[model samples]
Target: MRARLPDIAPAGSPATAPRTFLRAALAIAVLLAACSGEPDPATTPARDPDASAEGQAGPIISIRSDPETSAVPAWRAPDVPVDAGNLAQRKQEAAAALEADELFGEADDAIPLYLALREHAPADADVATGLERALGAVLQHGDAALAAIDDDRAALRRAQEIAAVAREVAPEREAVVEYLARVERADAAQQANRSGERALNARKIVVAGGKGAVAHFREALRLRPGDARAMQGLAAAESALIRQAELAANQDDYAAAEDWLAKAAKVRPDMDTAADARERIARQRASRVGNLRDLGLAALTREDLDAARRHLATLLRIAPAGDPAAVELRRQIELASHYGLFRPGQAFTEALDRGGRGPEMVVIPHGAFRMGAADDEADARDSERPSRNIRFDRGLAVSRNEITVGEFRRFVTATGYEARATRRGHSTVYDERSGSLVRRSGVDWRSDYAGKPAGDQLPVVHVSAQDAAAYAEWLSEQTGHEYRLPSEAEFEYMLRAGSQSRFPWGDGAPPAGAGNFTGALDESPGGRHWRNAFKGYGDDAWGPARVGSYSANAYRLHDLAGNVSEWVADCWHDSYRRAPVDGQAWINPGCADKVVRGGSWASSPEQTRSAWRLGSDRDTTNARVGFRVVRQI
Candidate 1:
């Protein structure tokens, strides 16, 4: 019999129910069981015809719940309602909730429920097929479940083993179809949950969680269209790039810094950080050129003229004429002219020029003189002994006194070039009483002399050849004249002053009043001896005196031989034999040294001869070294 019980007891027994007008359901299994011993349809009950067919029929028993145990006791349809053709129709509705609740825990638990509800279900082909398919899927997994379990475990716990296997295997293979209805409910809930601010913040955090934050932000923007947080995070990343650039700048890694700054600028055109980065890039380029200037100076001073040319060339290429260092930059160019460093497209502007401050005009005239040392000269090295004749077609204009700080200020104000300051070199001092030179620090143009006026017309001592050239070029542009470094020939020509004598005065020792020299004062039986004026104070105290304190040369040039060593235009050739006879700077593509002539006030008398030669670094500007300019005739 098939029965519907809404309140059945748990697994041990069936439940009773109050059913005043209850619907009944009959299963096909129950019908088959009840008819197993009953009539054969084909024989048509022949014996029953003799006994009256209706009276011979068995009693119509209806199964219903027991009053006390609520078990399936008897189910019945009233006698007037016994219609065999409509039995299936009446059976369906009563079986539904009963079937739904009973099969809650098996591998194919719902299949039995569907079977009980089948007859009552609506007449729709789609629903029928769906129900059949559901039952079939459960059955398939049920078979797989049986196979996956060991025979021993299946026998011991068959029902539990089936459920465990179904949970593990069936979901993986057919999760989409099995959970189609459930997923719809879940998806709706997920959409609503994602709309809140907390969800938004969580998304932002996830997007920036790792090394790929920038890329993640981009992807997140695509997924959740119009996300403002992503856009702002991208902007922050750009700022981070700017900070990286700043770090590079601090380390002087300019190339890397520029690359980083460029990215920042591209990401945010209107950002102030980008603007600052661009400005810093410009400053870095300028600084790079200037530092090269210092290196060029050092190389020139070391007589490495080739290295000097290379450095100076790089400097000019990196910095345009409008740069702040341009004036001094032009001087480097002019000085480099003597080294063949300039190209055809370059512009030649005269650098800074100041007229001689003293009364003497010290005109180193236009003529050739013997430029190397004599055989018998004391302390003559091989590079100096083979002195030869050097010619000059034009003379040089020289200062009677050292050019002073006050004079250089005018050039700086007009041209905006930086004036370098460094420790003083041992060359600028003069001693009169002991006829000895005295050298001291704090004697360069940048440092203040302890007891001096620091006048503009006082010659600029401690000046390097390149420094002199820079000053000359700057002066030239300001005055509209072609002021340049005097050639070695011109410097000696002016120092000799029309005399063929071994010295400007004579072949004898230098006169005490004529120039500053190295000797003891008054021959006072070893009162005080003079060494280099740069060494320390003595009869001739240490450091430079005021410009033009001594008598002028015959050319009226003051302090030429004694006070400072002069810079010349020629690249140092070691000898004069192969030098230009036509009074031009000897420029070879390979030469890297420079020549200094007319020994300083710190040099000995024999060292001050017209033919005496001193070579110095082109880049060095010490306390006693300076220059004079000459215009092309």
Candidate 2:
């Protein structure tokens, strides 16, 4: 019963088979279309061009597929005119989303959406207002970012971005542009400050009063108008320069001090320190002038003429050109040095002869002294009494020692003049065998008392007063100056020098080797009968030694006390009752005797006293007599 029901219809009925086949094909197509979610090609209608033109239905709108979401069927919809209500609803939805997400400023979100809505509905107040709000939000966000950035480049970038947005959104707005400009100025000011600080720290600002630093500081100020730090730095640099100038001045480096001071003046011409430093420098220079003047004057006083000249020259250089004291000091130095005799504590010669040597002279400065001897002086002769003040108004050149034999010989040779000893052909000499003075026919100025040959250095003796006068006159003629025998007063004045005692040394017994006196030859076999020997003193010589063999007196005059008696210009008088107070020779034409001062090698200690005086005939020649010349100044 289950198997045979449909068997008779199955084998050959054509109409029934065709109907079944058709039904199965139609159901397969419907199932495939539904599963694929695609409209049947037959049901898909063609776009209507007339409808699109009439705005009844626009061209079909094809929606693009989103790769991030599930795939949907790509369908085309007719672009129908949007409904006002629907568009309004869509705008409200987008505005609500923008508000909810607070994406009003976000360019990627609400800003683009608002822009699109504005394009569609250009007059929509809400869209315009929303777009404005979004733009403002963008500017605010950029500003916040810029403020948060520390790096200058980062800040600039942020500022530029804000400015760009503002230009695009509201081209007339200047807030962002102004902010960028301020940032630029601030950056420039900071850079200038840094550079200036570097230079200042390195001491490159050598000029005072901020001259070197001013340019940098000014630039910084221009960028950021009033900078206190820059002002302070400029002042400090100026102060440093002033201090350096002061230090140089303190060290007496006037040249360097002046240089630095000039720079300081350029820096701050009105600064108080600059004024003070200038004053101090002036005072220092003045003090130096005074110090130099003092040194030069002191040297002059000590007779150090060369040293005086050097110091005075330096003073003139440093002193003001017209300073009166400096001028006067220079004049004084010149006067002192005129004679070329400025050495102190030494003796020198002048007036060179053919032999290149002349009278050894001692410089005597103009001075006042008491001539002759004191009334109470022991052993002083009557002629030396009546002491009186005598002032030499001018400096004089006096011989340092008695004229020597060689010196006289040169004078005689040059003048070819006959001396009294050679003309007389005989002179008085000490006869050692007889121990008495005698006139010998062969003896002359060339022989000593003992008949020993006279050396060049021995004092020339046995010359008459006229012979000495002739010699002095010849010397004066040769040298073109007045050379003469010293007056009696001048002789005693020089012999005493500055001494007030009976003797030049002191009022004591003559010291051993004081001079060549009678005692000096006491032990000699031929000098026993000399009669006037100093009992306690001896010089170890029987006759005159070298002209300067003894110690010099204060005036550097040698052989003043002994060696030989010297002829003077005064006419012999019994006493000083009519003596002239002035240092002049008391001359009388009728006088037969000339005054002789000092003593001789044959004289006793009493006779060697500075004020002791004697007289001799004008033509007399003695073995114990010699003469020295004096030049009038």
Which is the leading candidate under TM-score? 2
Model 2 segments beyond 4 Å from truth?
1-348, 351-355, 525-532
Backbone atom clashes (below 3 Å) for every candidate: 53, 1
Give each model a TM-score. 0.37, 0.47
Q: Over the full model, what C-alpha lDDT does candidate 1 score relative to the true structure?
A: 0.48
lDDT of each: 0.48, 0.63
lDDT of 2 by residue, 163-190 (tens): 5445555556576566557546645654
lDDT, candidate 2, residue 576?
79
CA shift at 58, candidate 1, in angstroms?
Answer: 99
lDDT of 2: 0.63
Candidate 1: minimum summed lDDT over ten consecutive residues — where? 25-34
